[model samples]
Target: MKIGVLALQGDFDAHRKRLEELGAEVVLVKKPEQLDDIAGLVIPGGESSTFLNLLGKEGFAKLKGFVRMKPTFGTCAGAILLANEVENPKQVGLGALDITIRRNAYGRQVDSSIREGQFLHDPIEMVFIRAPKIERLGKDVEVVATEGRDPVMVRKGNTLAATFHPELSDDSRIHQYFLDLVTNGKH
Candidate 1:
């Protein structure tokens, strides 16, 4: 199956390499039209608002439509984009996940850190870089991973989101889980 990584900004290459390492065909999706070519999509970490500006009206609309139908995994700013409600000066989002996300809740770039989190039954290393915080989860949303009491990774239906950069770490489980999700056609 072909997996597309939103490559307009952020560390998209990392996700691409990680997905490729996991034995899936990878696409660096720089255009909205590329969405039609992939079975699943990975929206990488970046400045959320800039993602909006970069996507513009047409691209953003295309993305919003795609996420609702395809399996999508989003990290950092990508998570912000997938949220239903955005905080820290609220902004519009794709509304793919029933979540309230607060941008940069983990502090700034200088404050970024490598932390441990529980991913389902396993302990995983999570890289947080100007990360957002999952403030509230709607009833349908399930916590897939957490750092302390805060949810770092969450999912609902075909949409999966992470406040941390799973691709930045050596662990392949998170990406693997997403692959499994795509493979099994699970939410």
Candidate 2:
């Protein structure tokens, strides 16, 4: 199956590399039109506001429609984009997942750190760099993983959002889970 990584900014290439390692065709989507052929999409971490400005209104509209019909996995800032509510309140997002996110809740870039946490069946190393924290989850959302008391991974139907950068580490289970959602037509 083909998976497109939103290549506007951030660590999109890392996600693409990991997807390829899992034996899936990867596409770097720079334009809205590039989204058409992919079965799934991955939105990488970056500055949420900058990514929104880059998307513009038209790009955001198109992405909103795309996620509604396809399986999507969003990481860090990408997760911020998918959230229904942004904590700062000034930033606009795709609002695909019914959750509220507080940007840089883990403190600033200098405060970033790595921690071992329970995400899935095994322990996963979580890298938090100016990461957002999930404030609340709607009834439809399910928590997949957590870092201490904070919810790090969440899912709602075909949409999955993680506040940490799973791709930054060597684990591909999260990506693999997303691929399964695409292949099984779970969306």
Candidate 3:
């Protein structure tokens, strides 16, 4: 199967490398048209507002459409983009995932750190950098991982979002889980 990583900004290369390491054909998607060829998409961590400016109107519309139909995994700023509501200065989102996110809720960039979070009942390393916090989640959303009482990673249908950057860590489970969702067509 093929996976496309959003290359408009941020550390998209890291996501590309991780997906490639898992034996999937990876595409650094720089254009909205690229969305048509990939089975799944990975939106890497970046400035959410910057992504909006870069995507413009047509590209944003294309992305909004793609995420609704295809399996899409988003991390950090990507998570913000996927949320239904954004705070700490409201912003429009794709509404792909039923959750409310607060930008930089974990604190400033200097406060970034590595911590252990529970994933599928097992402890996993999570890297949070200027991360958004999942404030409120809709009933359909499942908490896939958590740091303390906060939902760091969540899933609902074909949309999976992580407030932390899974690609930044050594763990393959998170990415693998996303791949599984794509492979099984299990939302």
Candidate 4:
């Protein structure tokens, strides 16, 4: 299956490489038209506000529409964009997933860390770099994993979101899970 990674900014390259390693056709999506050719999309971690600014109105609207019709996975700041509500003010998002996110909830970039946690069916090494935390989840949202007392991974319908960077880690389970979602016609 072909999966697209939003290459507007952030760690899109890491995600692209990971998905490719998983044997999926990886597409680097820069323009709006590229969004149509992929079965699924991944929005990587970056500055949420800056990423939003880069999208402008047209790009943002198109992305929102695409997420509604396909399987989408978002990480870190990307997770914030997918949420229905954004905490810590500056409210900006695509509202693709029914949830609330708080930016930099884990502290600053200097406070970034790597922690081991069980997400899904395996132990995952999570890298939290100024990541947002899932604060409030909707009824349809299923908490897939957690870091201590906080929810780190959550899924709603065909959309999946994580507060940490799984691409940066050795584990490819998350990407594989997303691929499974697409291949299984979950979207």
Candidate 5:
């Protein structure tokens, strides 16, 4: 299956590499129309406001529709973009995931860190770089991974979100989970 990585900014190439290693076809998605050629999409970590500015009105609207129709995964800033609500200076979001996210909730860039987290019922390393925190989850949202008491990874329908940069980690389990969602057509 082909998975598209939103390559507007951030560490999108890392995601592409990870997916390719997992034996999946990868697409570097820039324009909204690229969404149609892939089975799933990954919105990579980047500056949230910057991503919004880059997306503009047309791209943002197109993404909104694409998220509703397919399995999409958003990490860090991408999580912020998919959130229903954003704080630390409120911002517009795609509203694909029913959650509230606080941008830079882990602190400034200086506070970026690596931590051990729980995922797939096992311990996994997580990388957080100016990451947005998943503040709250909706009733239908399932907590798939967590860092201590906080929900770091969540799933709602076909949309998956994480507060950390899984692309920065060596593990492929998270991406594989999303891939399963893509192949199963869970949306």
Candidate 6:
């Protein structure tokens, strides 16, 4: 299956490499039209505000529509963009996941760290880079993984999101889970 990684900014290349490692065809999508060519999409972590401007009105509109229809995974800033509500400077999102997110709740770049979290009942290393935190989960949202008492990874139907950079880690399970969503639609 073909997966498109938003290459506008952030660690998209890392996500692309991870998807490729899993034996999936990867596309580095820089334009909104590219969304039509993929089965699923990965929105990488980066400056959320910058991403908004980069996406422009048309691109953002296209993205907002795509996420609602396709199996989409958003990481960190991407998570912010997918949230129904955003704190620490609220911003509009795709509204794909019914949850609230607090941007940079883990502090700034200097406070970044590597930690461990549970995924699929297994230990997975988590890399946090100015990560956001899930403030609330709607009825349909599932907590896939957590760091301490806060959810770091969550899912709602075809939408999966993470506050941490799973692409930076060696574990591909998270990506694989997203792949499952892409292939199977839902559990």
- Each candidate structure's TM-score, on Cα atoms with residue i matched to residue i, is 0.97, 0.96, 0.98, 0.96, 0.97, 0.97
Off by over 4 Å in 5: none
Model 3, 5-95: lDDT tens digits are 9999999999988888999999999899999999999999999999999999999999999999999999999999999899999999999
Cα lDDT, all candidates: 0.94, 0.90, 0.93, 0.89, 0.90, 0.91
Question: In candidate 4, how many Å is residue 129 off?
Answer: 0.3
Off by over 4 Å in 6: none
**By TM-score, how accurate is candidate 2?**
0.96
Residue 89, candidate 1: C-alpha displacement in angstroms: 1.7
| The 10-residue segment with the lowest total lDDT in model 5 | 178-187
User: What shift in Å separates residue 31 of candidate 4 from its native position after superposition?
Assistant: 0.7
Higher-lDDT candidate of 2 and 5 = 5
lDDT of 4 at 95: 89
- Residue ranges of candidate 2 with Cα displaced over 4 Å: none
lDDT, candidate 4, 1-187, per-residue tens: 6899999899999999999899999999989889989999999988888888888999999999999999999999889999999998657788888898998987887989999888865678999999888889889899888888788999988889999999999988888888999989663
Per-residue lDDT for 57 in model 6?
A: 98
Task: State the local distance difference test value for candidate 5.
Answer: 0.90
Give the alpha carbon lDDT tens digit for every residue of 1-187 in model 2.
Answer: 7899999998999998999999999999989999899999999998888889889888999999999999999999999999989996557778889898999887878899999888765789999889999999998898898989888999999999999988998888888889998999663
In candidate 1, list every pair of residues with a backbone clash: none
lDDT of 3 at 139: 90
Model 4 alpha-carbon drift over 4 Å, by segment = none
List, residue by residue over 9-102, the lDDT tens digit for candidate 5: 9889999999999999999998888988988899999888999998999999999999998999999988999998999989999999889999
Give the deviation of candidate 1 from the true structure as CA RMSD: 0.9
Please report how far candidate 1 places residue 130 from its true position, in Å: 0.9
